[model samples]
Target: MKLTYGITDKLFVWFFIIVLIFFGTILVFYIDLQHIVKISANIVNKNNEISAASKKMIENLLSMEENEKKYRLLGKDDYLNYFDTARKDFEGQLKKIVQMEARGMAISDNWKNLYESYLNISPRLRDLKKAQPSKIPWIPVNVINEWIEKIYIARAENEYEVYLATTELNRRGQTSARNGLIGIGVSSMVGLLGIIFLAYTTLRPLRELLKGIRSISQDRFSEPIRIRSKDEFGELAGAFNEMSVRLKEEEQMRSDFVSMLSHEIRTPLTSIGESVNMIAEEVMGPVNDRQRKFLEIASSEIGRIGNLLNHLMQVSRLASSAIKIRPLSIGTSAFVSECIHGMAPAAEAKRIKIEAEIPPGIPNMMADPEHLKQVFINLLGNAVKFSPTKSKVKVLIEEDEAGTDLMFSISDKGPGIQEEEQSLIFNKYYQARRIRGHMDGVGLGLYISKHIVEAHGGTLWVESKIGQGSTFGFSLPTAGK
Candidate 1:
């Protein structure tokens, strides 16, 4: 089967493994504690049983001797029954003591053998008790005292062995419990360390992925992430880096396509425009009014197509950063007037007037002469196109006293740009929604104009409001001839 693990799945798998290890550690400690407790309980119970049996044997021996004295003094058979009963209880106690396994109790078996010898001498003593002190050769008092002393000694020895075994059992229990606690502590520490290491390894690549994702969100696709692990994160990083590369390539291809279309298509359109211009000028023959009107429409359509193609070419160049500005000194008065003259035909058709407020002694502007002409053409053309018939389009020029820069402005009296539209007007392909009438061409003119002004170390801006006149302008720094 093929293995498929994503980031979430991989992290979960690792976490489960760690948890299982912790549980396994706990289980080991639990099993050890159970064994220790059972053994300790057994040790305590056995010691108690052994001590009880020994104690019973000692008590019965004392009772039997006292009852035998009563029988010998009173010559009573009823007292002799008490001695017989004591003897039977002693035998039972000894049997119990012998059956127990004395694991740690040394001398327990020897003590039991010595206790059995007391039974053999018991029957002879019973016979002697009936015959009186003078009839028996040996004295009952000495023999009884000797046997009782031996029984006491054996009982004490058994009690001492039980005491030693119980003490050792307690010590072993404490030792086992202590070792279990230490094992638990060590295992927990190791588990915690392992979890920390695992988290670091897992989150490291995720952090890198976040960084790369943020970069893409901000439109940055230059660098690819490099991770050299064989885990799931490594695979994900490789995929993400591949996407970044593809995005970069696609952006390049887009620019190249635009650049190619603009260059490849401009040539034939230029030839067609030239041919139409010649025929319309009557170079071939004179034309009727109806034919003339058709020629005018064709000419205008050709001019519009040519303008669109020009804007597209400029856009491709600016997008790829291939445009280089060649700045030179130029007279603001002469340059501005020539740019205004080119738009005169359009202004004349709408009965719109151009007024220049040029002050003499204005410093020559440092700019790309061709680019500046285009900038003026865009600004002046927009002002005239938006102005109503018989309205004013004013061109203003000003200079700074430091001989550093000159400012050129065009103001039009028309349905002025709204507050929101002023900033967006310079963006590529943006047209104001509150436009007065039909507008020609794509929105590249103002955008192209803005770039050209900035390339010459100047700034372009607009000032306008709805229902008020609009003024669009730029500042140009002074430069050497």
Candidate 2:
């Protein structure tokens, strides 16, 4: 059976893993520390005690030798008593060392034997002096001194063993600390990787959902979000996809309705326009000046309705991909100059200066002249329409940085578009809130123009800020491409 992991499940698993790693690291550190502590205790309590006992034995042995020599030289019984006391202290310390060895100390048997031989030799020397009191010259003083040196060597060896044990204990402690740090570092790294993984898993779906939302907002409902996880985000994605499909169906129905309605209205609108023109021209009957003026207004309004129908038809065609591009090599400079001249009258009515900054030697582009002209006229018309009286509308033509496309920009000094509304402007039937009632358009010009430019492998974009101005720019591929 396949297991489905949700976002919460993944988070729980990662958290658990991190916790396990943390505790496991701590456990390892605890075990290692316990071992180090054990070694440390052994060195401090046992090894160090053995070393101290060896030192005391050496001190007592030296004192015994001094007292025995003094007893023979001064013939003093007090020196003999001092020698016996030192011997007893030395034996007591040796016994303590032996007991420690039996408990678990690691003193060598060879050292113990040497200590025993030294003790036996001391009693033997006392016996020899007692047996031959007048024969002091025959005393084994050199042998006693030799045994003293041997015991001193044994004590040094014991101290060296203690030093080795202490060094080993220190090594173990350092190793434990180093291993603990390594374990902690590994655990932390694992935790960090888990966090990164979890974030990626979570944010990937969110990003996809955001992209789908943006697509839907732009009226692009064809592409569905693809999130495969068994999480809440995945369920959301499924719902989002369903909504997109429904929205796409609804948009298609609306487009078809608009197209059919525009077609149904166009024939009567044309006939009405002709009739109004005929009445204004006194073809049916002679009319008064007021009647003629009203007829003229009717004619103008009829013409506007006709234009709106035409725009709606065009938008429908664009939606259905029915419009075809007839590409031709068009001269850039002359074409732009003509569009500028056509818009000059509109600019003059607004008292706006239309400035053209076309440099020489600009490359020609391959595009359908009629379609491209429509886009130019729409952009320039918007610039002239929205521009403040006496303000400047600048038309700029140039090549992009890559020199692969021709760039046209229409900048107007008008109440500019808001930043929030910029992206929505290219969407069909979407108008800026501020200009909804003030503007004359049904908001299809830029939408139609954007589609036209994009159809020719170009892009249309706007840069604007309130109270500053707006610049609508587009790029078309040059003839070389």
> Model 2: how far is 383 from its true place, Å?
1.3
> What lDDT tens digits, residue by residue, belong to model 2 across residues 1-481?
9988888888888888878877887787788778767777777876677667767766777787787678778877687677767777777777776676777767766457756776665565454435544553322557556656766676677678667767877877787788778878887898889889888888999999999899877856649888888789889999999999898899899999999999899888888888888777789889998898888788878888888988999999998989899899899989999998999898899899988998899999999999999999999999998888989999999998898999889999888888888999998888889888877999899999999999999999999999999999999999988
Clashes in each model (backbone N, CA, C under 3 Å)? 0, 0
Worst 10 residues of 1 by lDDT: 132-141
Prediction 1 global C-alpha lDDT: 0.76
Alpha-carbon shift of residue 351 in model 1 (angstroms): 21
**Candidate 1 regions off by >4 Å?**
1-38, 41-45, 101-110, 123-187, 220-222, 267-481
- Look at candidate 2 and give me any clashing residue pairs: none
The reply for model 2, stretches above 4 Å from the true place, is: 65-77, 101-157, 281-284, 331-334, 357-365, 399-404, 477-481
Q: How many pairs in model 2 have backbone atoms within 3 A of each other, for residues 3 or more apart or on separate chains, i.e. clashes?
A: 0
Best by lDDT: 2
Q: After superposition, how far is residue 410 of candidate 2 from its true place, in Å?
A: 1.9
